[model samples]
Target chain A: MGPLVPQEIIGADWNLFIAFAIGIGFGFVLEQAGFSSSRKLAGMFYGYDTVVLKVFFTGAITAMLGLLFFSLFGWIDLNLIYVNPTFLGSAIVGGVIMGAGFIIGGFCPGTSVCAAAIGKIDAMIFIGGIFLGIFFFAEGYPLLKDFYMSGSMGPLKVSDVFGISGGVLALIVIITAIVMFKLGELAEKRWPREEY
Target chain B: MKTKYMNPYLAGVLLGLVLLMAFFFSGRGLGASGAVKSVVVAAVDVVAPEHTANSGYYSKYVGEGKSPMKAWLVFEMIGVLVGGFLSGAFSGRLKWKVEHFPGITANRRLIFAGMGGILFGFGSQLGRGCTSGSALTGMASLSVAGFVSMMVIFGTAFALAFFLRKNWI
Candidate 1:
């Protein structure tokens, strides 16, 4: 019923416009959430701010639940949405690398863009580094193709892997998020950092 | 005076709604790295068309009437820039400065920032997405890849936080 562009309800010509609109909301929310500040984003791991933890999990669950309801209401076709395909080796290794980057760099690609928009010099350099990093990856693609293309699992959902319904997995994740939120609040109290 | 940041939960909900809108209208979630990838692919194609044509990786995205720069993600990213600027302007947060800990030199912070960006950019390609494209969007769809990426990325950061304390704390 939805996914208007894919379903032909919305013309293909409007795709870029729609994408721009969505990005606006996304960037606005991120900036408003203080994701523009690398120091604030990095605070999650330090037991000081914990805003990242709170915001990330809450945002994730909100979307998850929203999708479920949309499907239930027949407003959208859950089957039509894109789910990221899994490549176990790259996923794990890449995640580890990104983890190190997050701690060291303070901002992820999206957040860095937002930070740069507000004229953060560090963020601008970070973006230049991103460009160079991607360039290096492209140059080395011939050597990395084997591993990059390995362990492909086609768009498998967590519910499918666990042999549970999507609803059940959503429930469990919600519970987990609540637990994490509590821990986040506690962490904030235990180690308060002055607001920047 | 700078306005206080929005409540995290409220911001999260707003972010979630935006993500939902993306899925509802376009049938995909939010992404950041993919747009960067598109730009990279485009740049490479322009610099060395034959190299890209011969390369296994770049070939997948370029050629055959496909214009990488016109990608949906690219337009979305441009919007993100505008939106971020608008929000920053409204909140009185727009300023030309380097954000860093008082203990560290700005140059040191810039160097780490660049290094971190490089690693993240490389890793995002290898992982097929960064935080927004993989972890957050993946989790929203309940994909195992999403959960795994989320756990590992956050886990590694937490594990290494102590070592990087001098940079932030």
Candidate 2:
């Protein structure tokens, strides 16, 4: 009923096709959300614009809730879905590096690709940088192999860590997001700078 | 010129719905860096099959009876390009231009963009996914990795935002 490819509900060929369609939606929403602009994205940190926080948290919460509901309705098998494995040390280290890249480059891989499509030089550069970065990692894999594989916590969920239900966690996230949204709006007003 | 953006909450809802559909239909979330990895693997496989086969990092992706480019992420990335183009066109943002801060030259911006990209690329591999795959989709599943990655990414960016203030602010 769910996870078409993994469960053999859909053929391999259709998997990529579905991925393409999902990607279209992902790209469309990203652009519409003003994710195509580096200045707009960077504003999240400067307190000038909180669009990043608003959209990001909203999206995360929305999906979290959706998954919970889907599971309850038996519409999708949450267990069938892929969960990114946690390698604590690498996750933190990689995330930190990417954060620096985000602020400095002004785009993540997805946003960079979307921006590149709309003729953004910065985005294109970011994409190029991503390739170079991957290439560098490939070439120097030996040097970072140990750290990359360190801190294996297996695949675990935040809910599991807290010994709470997914629904409860989702509820908590929604409430936190609401509070943050209010604060974000306040920060924007307090800082109020020119739009990029 | 007026810059228009969709309502944040609405857009977020729409994005969430899309993510939900992804799970319902494919039992997976969205991704971006994986596509690039496919491209890298394919390119390396074509140019230096032996090298890719011998390498610990590249060999895992390149194998017999398979084309690296034929992965799910790659096709989705192609879709992302088309969808982004359509959205930009409809929104009147499909113009060809270099976006940068006034303080920096276009060349400087491009240079940093490339450098930043390189760092992001490397980081994504180490981190196991990029923003879309790791943070957004990961968080949706309530995966600890996802939350941790999200914190690292945003926290690091916030920490460094002051130093790079001129680049954006």
Candidate 3:
């Protein structure tokens, strides 16, 4: 009933069309959540605005719980879902570099696209930068082959790493998010900003 | 601002619902960088067919009756563009301007934006995903890579935010 594409519940071409629709939903939510602004995004780090934290955690947990329930109701087969594979060294290294980019550039790959759609010049440039970066990596693939393939730990779950069930882990994350949300409010109140 | 945006919590819930829909339907979460990678692959193929085939990275994405642009992520990205445009129109934020702090010049903002994009782009490829692909989607699936990527990205930003404080707050 679920994972319509993988299960052939939808045809190949139709799967792509569904992907487009899903993408629209994703982008619409991102912009509505004020994710199109670099300043608003960067503010999460400054304690000025923590909308990123609130929306991001809320979205993640919501989906996590949704999957749990969907599987429980026998609507979706959890095993068929695509899990992002773990490449330990690369994930940490790549994320650290991206973090630097987020603070300095103020827009990530996804957010910049939304911002660019609304005619944000900086976002346009950011998109260009992404192109250049990918090009550079592609050309330098020979040099990066080793590091990129290092720490290949195949699709492993965080819960598996921590010796817990997905439900238990999801609950733990929800609780942590609640605590963080409260702290985020305090931080924002303590240090308010006039800009959006 | 005469009007305000949606409530953060509500937006989060709606966003989560969207993510849930993605999983329920496609068995995959949202992504942005993968689409761009397809574009790059397609561009290289068009520019140098022989070179694309010869390259280690480019060849994998090109050839065998495949158009790099014909990927799920690519189509999804098109939807993202439309959705973003619609949302901006609805919110009256569809203006052409360079957004920057009063403290920084437009040129400075664009420069930093490009530089940051370059880093993010490279990292996404190396990390095999971006904020949406690796962090948000990964975390929801309870993947260890997702947690590690999320923590590292945010933690690194938190550590560097003070040094770059002049740019935002």
Best by DockQ: 3
Name the top lDDT candidate.
Answer: 1
Runs in model 2 with CA error above 4 Å? Answer: A193-196, B1-3
Q: Residue A166 lDDT in model 1? A: 86
Error of 2 at A108 (Å): 0.5
lDDT of 1 at B33: 86
Better of 1 and 2 by DockQ: 1
Candidate 1 per-residue lDDT, tens place, A14-89, comes to: 9999999999999999999999999999989888888888788888999999999999999999989999999999
- lDDT for B17 in candidate 1 is 92
Instruction: Name the docking class for model 1.
Output: high
lDDT of 3 by residue, A40-147 (tens): 898899898889999999999999999999999999999999999999998999999999989989999989999898889999999999999999999999999999
Residue B149 Cα positional deviation in candidate 1, in Å, after optimal superposition: 0.8
lDDT for each residue of candidate 2 in A1-196, tens digit (9 for 90 to 100): 6766778888866888898998899899999998998888888999888898999889998889888887888877888998888999999999999998998888899999999889997798788789889988988998999999998988899999999999888889889899989999898888865654
Q: lDDT for each of the candidates?
A: 0.91, 0.88, 0.90
Model 1, runs deviating above 4 Å = B1-3
Worst 10 residues of 2 chain B by lDDT: B1-10
By summed lDDT, the worst window of 10 consecutive residues in model 1 chain A runs over: A187-196
Sort the candidates on DockQ, descending order: 3, 1, 2
lDDT by residue for model 3 over B22-133, one digit each (tens)?
8888889988999999999998888899999999999898888878998989998898888898999998899999999999899989999999999999999998899999
Kindly report the fnat of each predicted structure, to 2 decimals: 0.83, 0.85, 0.87
